[model samples]
Target: MYPIIRMVKQMILHRNDPPLSAMGTHVSHHRCWPWDIDLWMELNNGRTLTLLDLGRIPLAHRIGLISVMRQKRWSMTMAGVSVRYRRRIRTFEKFEMRSRAVYWDDRFIYLEQTMWKQDGECANHALYRSAITDRDGIVPPAQVIEAMGADNTRLQAPEWVQGWIDAEAKRPWPPMQD
Candidate 1:
């Protein structure tokens, strides 16, 4: 089951917190409950992505993206992701999650997120490509940025993120020989 209840709690708790810059980091904490573990006694890979939603949504709220999306009746969706799991996270272990938007191109926004154990070990990290959409279809990221009332100034996406974007572009959709 998804931790939607916990995610809502987080939203209410941080509702009044100060906002961050478009490229600023948002740090949030979470724990690995027994239910979060897989049969191998570690955090399930799917659960990790769901938990990442807690960090990314808060980051979006802090950066004013959520507000703009709401005001414009737009929605956000994850278009793609590439993740790496380095260390196992055991039950009841607390971890700090860090999320930030690194950059945006005309069509998509790129974000980087991580889970760091209390002992300072990085358990996992992921790069996400998100799209803002409306009834018409996918809204250009440039339009989303402009709507947020922030300058459209962009920094270079890290080499790795750019590489992933390139690789994803080469993949065929509705895959399988037709």
Candidate 2:
């Protein structure tokens, strides 16, 4: 089941936060609940992705993207993601999540997120490719930014991010045919 209640809690917690720039980072704290663990008693890999929402949505809200989407009747969706898991998170353990928009291109917005242990070690890191869509199809990042009243100028992505983007382009879609 999706953690809807926790998402609401995060929304309410940061409801009064000041708006941030397009590339600004949003930080949120969370705990690995018993229900969030796997049979081996550590945070489930899938649950980690779900928990990322608790930070990402608030991030969109703080950056005014949610309001823009609402006003334009648009929706945001994840197109792809790459995650690296390092440290283990035990049940009842607390950690901080950081999410930020690294940059955007003609088609998608690239985001980087990290989960940090209490000891300050990075437990996991992820890069996300997201798209905004309307009734017709995917909306360009430039258009989305303009609608959000943010500067539409293009920002160069970091070398590593650009490398990932380049690599993804070579991946065959609708993969694994017999």
Candidate 3:
């Protein structure tokens, strides 16, 4: 089940929080609920990714990108992601999620996020490739940045993110195609 209501709650909670730069971090708190766990009594792997949405969307809101998207009738979607899980989150345990935009290329935006336990341990971390879209099709990263009014401040994409882009470029569209 999608946690729409929980997402709404998170939106309202962080609505008044301070804004941040494109590369700055936005943090949100969440608990490992029973529904978020698996048969082994740990947070489900898939649930971890879904809950990260709660953090990323608010980060967008704080950076004012959400408003820009709404004004332009644009939308955003996750194209791909790579994540690392280093620890287990038990049901009822509390964790803080942190998200931020890391870089962007001509077509995709890259974001990095992490879930941290109260003791400052990272439970998981992920790098995401996302695309902005409109009714016509995916919006180019340059256009999205222009809409955000950050067009003049160009930043180089990080090396690791560039590496991921390079690897994806060499992958065939229909991987099964001979």
Candidate 4:
């Protein structure tokens, strides 16, 4: 089941936070629960992605993206992601998550997120490509920016992020066909 209750808790916890600029980072704390673990007694990879949402969604809210989406009847979707895990999080262990928008092109917004252990070591990091959409189809980032009244500052993705984007462009789609 989706952790809807945890998500609502996160939403309520950050409800009074001051608004942030579109590119500003949001920091949040979370703990791994027994249910979040896999058989290896560490945080499950899939649950890690779900927990990242505790930061990402509030990030969208702080940047006013959620409000704009609600008013414009638009929706957001994750188009792709790349994650690297380096450390294990045991049940009941606390960690901090940081999330921010790295850049955006005409088509998509790129977000970077990281999880840090209590000792300050990075547990994992992820880069996500997100798209805003309407009933017609995917909405352009430019239009989304205009709708949010955000400064249309052009941002260049970092070299590593660009490399990932380039690599993804070359990857074959719909694999394993008979």
Q: Which candidate number would show the highest lDDT if scored against the true structure?
A: 2
Off by over 4 Å in 4: 176-178
Q: Candidate 2 on 65-162: residue-level lDDT in tens?
A: 99999999999999999999999999999999999999899999999999999999999999999999999999999999999889988988999999
Residue clash pairs of candidate 1: none
CA shift at 55, candidate 1, in angstroms? 0.6
Name the candidate, 3 or 4, with the larger TM-score value.
Answer: 4
Instruction: Output the TM-score of candidate 2.
Output: 0.98
When superposed on Cα atoms, how far off is each prediction in RMSD? 1.2, 0.7, 1.5, 0.9
Ranking by TM-score: 2, 4, 1, 3
Query: Over 4 Å off in model 3, which ranges?
Result: none
Per lDDT, what order, best first?
Answer: 2, 4, 1, 3
State every prediction's TM-score relative to the real structure: 0.96, 0.98, 0.94, 0.97
lDDT of 1: 0.91
- Candidate lDDT (C-alpha), each: 0.91, 0.96, 0.90, 0.94
Question: Which parts of model 1 are misplaced by more than 4 Å?
Answer: none
Q: Which residue pairs collide in model 2, if any?
A: none
Which candidate has the top score in TM-score?
A: 2
